[model samples]
Target: MNDRWMQGPQFLYMKEEDWPYTSRENYHAISEVVSVIPTSKFESWGKLLRVTAYVCRYMDALRGIKRENLALSSEVFQRAERVLYRHIQAESLLSELEFAASLRKVAKKTAQCSSIILSMKPYLNENGVMRSMSRINNAKWLNIYTRHPVILPDNNRATRLLIRHYHDKFRHIVVNEIRKKYFIPKLRQLLIRVRKHCFRCKMNVAKATPPEMAILPEVRVSAFTPPFSYSTVDYGGPFDIVHGRKIEKRWICLFTCLVTRAIHIEIAYTCSTDSFILCYRNFLCRRGTVRKMFSDRGTNFIGAEKLLKTT
Candidate 1:
């Protein structure tokens, strides 16, 4: 029937008691009722009430003439609920078993003796025994048969998991925390490896590796070059001196031959442009004029260069 027919006085005014009683005849009326029922009402209902209501509505929508169809519908619903519950339980159990297997693999790897463990043999209650047992002396300090099954070695699989889970903390922090509950052989090494490879730790702490050295400049590497032909100049410290019963300061202007590695030092009374010009004059008179000079961007050197250019 059309929605207009259902909305008319015939269906709208009809009492629940007057509606079709059997499932075969009540299909249209059940559909209309289900469509009009608010989804909120279904959500608010208890599980039992919800299941009951669902089954009743389903049975009403069935078109079979036999009364046994209602019983079959209830049986099918119950069976489906049981199957769904079993499926969920099976999935959960399967996941747990898989996790346990992974842990067992980790345990086996941890139990194996490594080079580091063998090195500790001398410290095993047999030689150079100390007064107190520490984590370092694993042979005497750890019961491998019992602890190995549960605890991993310092650089093993379990330690990696702990480092990643704990945000790649420092080795001391990770080792100290693990020591409280479990003893892992060479735990420090394992933690270090984890921290080294951990993406977060690498991003935060990694440094750029130095690239290969570039070819030396021609002025620095050339052979048989005259001294001071290519030179670098820089000012050194002011040295205290006694002159006429008064303390005075003098600066050393250092000129270095880039190719020959020869050095020339001249004393300057002050770090002014005039003083630098005088120093340069003394260097040029002694060593000849340099073809090129390299100096830091000092104001005195700049002024001297400008004076030389003008002269």
Candidate 2:
């Protein structure tokens, strides 16, 4: 029956029953009768767009069916058409697209089944058995086995069961025999190199380095202002010469005159505590005694600081 009017009228009737927008003076009267329905889960704009497209396609398909005069038998197509029309009235594009895509998937599955039946002879039996060559071959083999009953390799008959059971073993035996007959013996073989750890040797070589600390030259020590007068002292350079070969590691002593802002940098042969102390004392002698100095918390500097405090 042409029940398209149900889409508009029924939708309006249902909305009225729910009393969705009746919050005026009739609010109490509406609320007494209307139970609020839960909102729809499909709320995304993209989903709506997809559904709309589906409905459009389904409606197009229904139009085609109508043009061909095949609407009577195509019940599903008709239902899809009604649904598409409803979605169109609702202004939901995504719902139409989603439904159309679903219908297309069903059509594709039906086509696939039809194709399979066409390709395979005696396709489906009345009992729903799909007749194929492999099944027919197995049936023939069973008939032969029942009559003859010969003692093959597996019970002396090269049947499907025996073939399946020993196929992999038979394949390996054949390949190995072929290799024995044809493979060259005197050829030099390329061996693959595999890495393996020698546990004993690894344990023997596992020794820890001495805990000698060498601070990087840039580790700055904050000096207190005016009331606390201290200069920041740190190590400097691994300097690169224009001609000399670059050293992997080198050390230089650095002293900053906090008051004068005069920087003293000396290349250190070794960053020993004695060497650092000598550098600090030399700075004090050259440019008046600095009562306090700030430097990185390295072993050498800490030791020098302690020695200066004692003196």
On lDDT, the leading prediction is 1
lDDT (CA) for every model shown? 0.57, 0.42
In terms of lDDT, model 1 sits at: 0.57
User: Could you give candidate 1's per-residue lDDT for residues 197-262 as a string of tens digits?
Assistant: 767767778799899999999889878767899999999888999999999999999999998788
Q: What TM-score would every model get versus the actual structure?
A: 0.42, 0.31
> Tens digit of lDDT per residue, candidate 2, span 1-311?
55665555445656566755534665342211001211133433234334444444445574563345533334444343333223232232232223223445553444434332223222222322222322234455354323222111112111222222222244324323322211111111100000013344346568988998886333234344432144677887666545466544557787775554667776665678898877766776666665567777899888877886798
Superposed by TM-score, candidate 1 places the C-alpha of residue 26 at a distance from the truth, in angstroms, of 35
**Candidate 2 regions off by >4 Å?**
1-47, 62-229, 240-249, 257-262
On the 0 to 100 scale, the lDDT of residue 197 in model 1 is 72
Best candidate according to TM-score: 1
